[model samples]
Target: MKLNKHTVATRYAKAYYNLAEEHDCIKEAFDNMMDIRQIFGENPGLGLVLSDARLTLAQKRPIVDNLIKNFPELMQNFVLMIFDYDRMGDMELIVDEFEKLYDHKNRTILAKVTTAVPLTEAQKTRLADVFVKKLDGKKVIFDEVVDPEILGGVIIEAEHQIFDGSIRLNLETLKKQIAK
Candidate 1:
């Protein structure tokens, strides 16, 4: 049976969320995941270390131990589970999905804006305000990214929604209209 990445990610993320809920450590899980992602991102060598399945658990034990310092018990359990499943490469993806699940449970909706250039403070505030109004009862967490691919204007993405209004998008729309 082939496993789809999103389904696999959801399964692993949900399992961790369950453990976190039992221990009242959902926030801890989120923070620990963020920390782990940063560690993996900053030290690409960790991937090589984790991928060596030939290394005995005893040999790999120190790596896991030293890497787990101050992590919550739930995260420690998650780490152990990953090691058991040989899914350490998917840790970052798992964390991201876990965060989405966690936020869903908490009624937190994240909104991301990508534009060709940095948004002015007033523009960011107004954009967030508009999304907040549209997503009433859910917290609108805003993230504005600068993407040259956008050419101009903004691409707004919220939980369950995407509003692409960039110049690049408009050009594509115009091209489609002409073709039709």
Candidate 2:
């Protein structure tokens, strides 16, 4: 039986999250993971290099060690374990799963909001307030996107739901109604 990437990542992340919680270092672990994710993002080839079959664990140890030298002992061990298990390629997925656990623990929701223009701080606050109620009071964090193609109104995607109130969509609806 072959486990998928997500399953492997979730198992590792859940175990890591539990360990961090036990050590009372969840925040620190989360911060370090975010930084590590950024590092992976900035260096797209890092994962490939670490996962290369030609490079033995001894050769990859120094690189991984140097990259995470400043992190706490828990995180250091976690990274080493992942590397030791040849799961370096799934580091990003692990980080993402860890983030989801962190957010759920903190009662936070990440909403991707798209609008025709940039929203003011006031608008953002109001939007968040509205979504907060809809989301059963989870603190809302906006990932704002500006797309002129929407023409007007807003489109919100969060928690596997999409609230598309864009003018373009409304116009299409109207056109269909007229045709009918």
Candidate 3:
């Protein structure tokens, strides 16, 4: 079987995670990973700087070092490692891989629930409780979002399954049934 991208990312990310854990810098490393992801994702110029062959490590390292000066030393070292390996283009995916490692280590599920309208605090609490109960009392890192395009109701994505009960889905189903 062919090795998938996720597998490759996980392998590299796990190495970083192991190093971060050894240095007792998982949180700092994770946070810096997030920051590096955002910086690379949102700023093409920053990415170009890293990818440019004309820019030597002597030049690039100091620039990046100053930007992440306050982050943990391991994070700084990780940046250098990535730069040395020329894996800067995969920064976002690597961070996502690292986050999965962090979440798995912490026994948490980062959930995302979206509804047409914002749920009340009580509603959020109740839904979060439902997830907690359903997961055999495992922690649910519940996150909720509102999308008016859904028209109404909710679409919850937790673990790897989706629970879609949105008004938009209902209307589509009704339309399909009517067409039939």
Query: Which prediction has the highest lDDT against the true structure?
Result: 2
Model 2 gets an lDDT of 0.93
Task: Report the number of the highest-TM-score candidate.
Answer: 2
Q: Pairs clashing in candidate 3?
A: none
On TM-score, who's better, 1 or 2?
2
TM-score of candidate 2 relative to the true fold: 0.90
Better of 1 and 2 by lDDT: 2
For model 2, the stretches where C-alpha displacement exceeds 4 angstroms are: 175-180
Q: In candidate 3, what are the lDDT values of residues 1-180, reduced to their tens digit?
A: 866667767887999999988888888878888888777777776756866789787888777677668766777777777777766656667889998888888767788899988898899888878877776546777687889999998998877889898999999999999999
Which 10 successive residues of model 2 have the least lDDT summed? 133-142
Ranking by lDDT: 2, 1, 3
TM-score of each: 0.78, 0.90, 0.74
Where is the poorest 10-residue window by lDDT in model 3? Answer: 84-93
Off by over 4 Å in 1: 145-153, 164-180
Q: Write the per-residue lDDT of candidate 1 for residues 117-138, one digit (tens) a residue.
A: 9988898778777777777735
The Cα local distance difference test for each model comes to: 0.82, 0.93, 0.80
Model with the higher lDDT, candidate 1 or 3 = 1
- Please report the TM-score between candidate 1 and the true structure: 0.78
